[model samples]
Target: MPDDRVEVEEEPVSETRLSLTADCGSCFGLCCVALPFTASADFAINKEAGKPCRNLREDFGCGIHTQLRQKGFNGCTVYDCFGAGQHLSQGTFGGTDWRREPKSAQQMFEVFPVMRQLHELLWYLNEALTLAPAKPVHADLRELLARTEALTGGSAEELARLDVPGHRQQVNLLLLRTSELVRAQVPGKKRNRRGADLIGAKLRKAELRGADLRGAYLIAADLTGADLRDADLIGADLRDAQLAGADLTGAFFLTQPQVNAAKGDPSTRLPGRLTRPAHW
Candidate 1:
């Protein structure tokens, strides 16, 4: 029941100025090449790790970029790299591309996944620092943020050798504390459903304000018109969940990929930072 949702998807939400936002143009298609996918509901074909996706273009763009979902690549539409691609391409590897520098390809692929985890942590820590309810840990969060940010700047070899999970555990500790502080401010008793198996459960118009749904499986749940203000949704699987008319204002740690996987309409209120998914 742990928050494995963090590792399930990597793409950062678009339409945000957040440092973790994925700008594919600034990247070298690391996700397309460094990560593998299997033919499933999310992907259209089975690809081996470290192999470039056939849809990848010569300039590191997806040839089917505009039609990913249409082409059975639903995963590509929601998968985010948390800006790790650009950070590695332009900063860590100094614009050295895998295709151009065949020798560095394997090394770059190895370092990408590691760098991605670091950047994901950065995104969460940055979010924690912004919550006034979590102000008690602001100073500590800033320190952790600085440390994680510094890790992202390490050399490719250093990044490849990084103990990412160990570092993630260290970061998770403070994040847990931050979540407690923020949720404590809720008026009524907050529901503790961390990592609950609520897949396809009927939760229509549920009062889940300030709920702790971290890593919860909400797949296909009917959450229409639910009040989810100030909820912690880090790593929550929301695929095909009914969010029509749901209000998620002030929800923390909810990423774009989660939103993309859910079904919503114009009436579905989202946090200020997240835009309505194109498919919705």
Candidate 2:
């Protein structure tokens, strides 16, 4: 099937952290073929699990690269390969491009997603370690950060054989420790308010799974990877909220408009179709 996934413009290089700016030009589009997507609100059309997008050229660049969104493939716009795609295509695999060696294509593609996932965890874990107040856990943080970085540099064959979920669990443990170190200082007492004003709060990774957030002002909140499953978002204003990697799978009373008004990253899994929240 034609790669109908929407593509967003390349973000400003400076917008990404220095740690993430590893060379990716050497990669041969392994991510495009390795990851799978089906037609839904996020994707424009249905595609088989392993089939390459029709727009992918023999050179491994998108044929509609510059016009992805215009061509009705917005999903591509929000994707960030985290340098994993290219790293495996060129560095780990010694620039053995997938096209020439058709047999290696599947393995190369498979490793891309796995490496990308590991890179994503490293990104968040690194971010957590940077918080000033989490200084108490500095020693542990440094150890974990080094471990995560080492994992990123693992060989393609090693990465392809990695257990991503298990790695994620280890990283999650550190993140939880980081969160506790920070939140422990802040009073957990809930303030009295009928409809509290929480607009644009930095609630990233907060455990709000079953919290009563009804009719609350949540505009532009950074909800990256927050556990919102089964939470009450009824009448909650989600305009400009960042739902990157957030889980709203079973969130209650989350109307389409509420989701439509917010900004969502590709990792943001919502209950239903609605283009990523508009205020990206």
lDDT on C-alpha atoms for all candidate structures: 0.86, 0.63
Candidate 2, residues 100-178, lDDT tens digits: the string is 8778877777777787776666555554554445577767766766776777678767887778888777876676555
In model 1, which regions exceed 4 Å deviation?
Answer: 1-18
After superposition, which runs of candidate 2 have C-alpha atoms over 4 Å from their true positions? 1-24, 185-280
At residue 170, candidate 2 shows an lDDT of: 80
Candidate 2, backbone clash total: 11
Tell how far residue 244 is off in model 1, in angstroms.
0.4
Top lDDT: which candidate number?
Answer: 1
Q: Assess every candidate by TM-score.
A: 0.93, 0.61
**Residue-by-residue lDDT tens digits, candidate 1, 1-280:** 1221121122333322336878899898999988989999999999998999999989888999889988999999888888888989999989878778899999999898998888888888877766767777878888888888888888988898889989999999999998888878777889999999999999999999889999999999999999998799999999999999998877888888899999999999887777789898
Candidate 1: deviation at residue 84, Å? 0.6
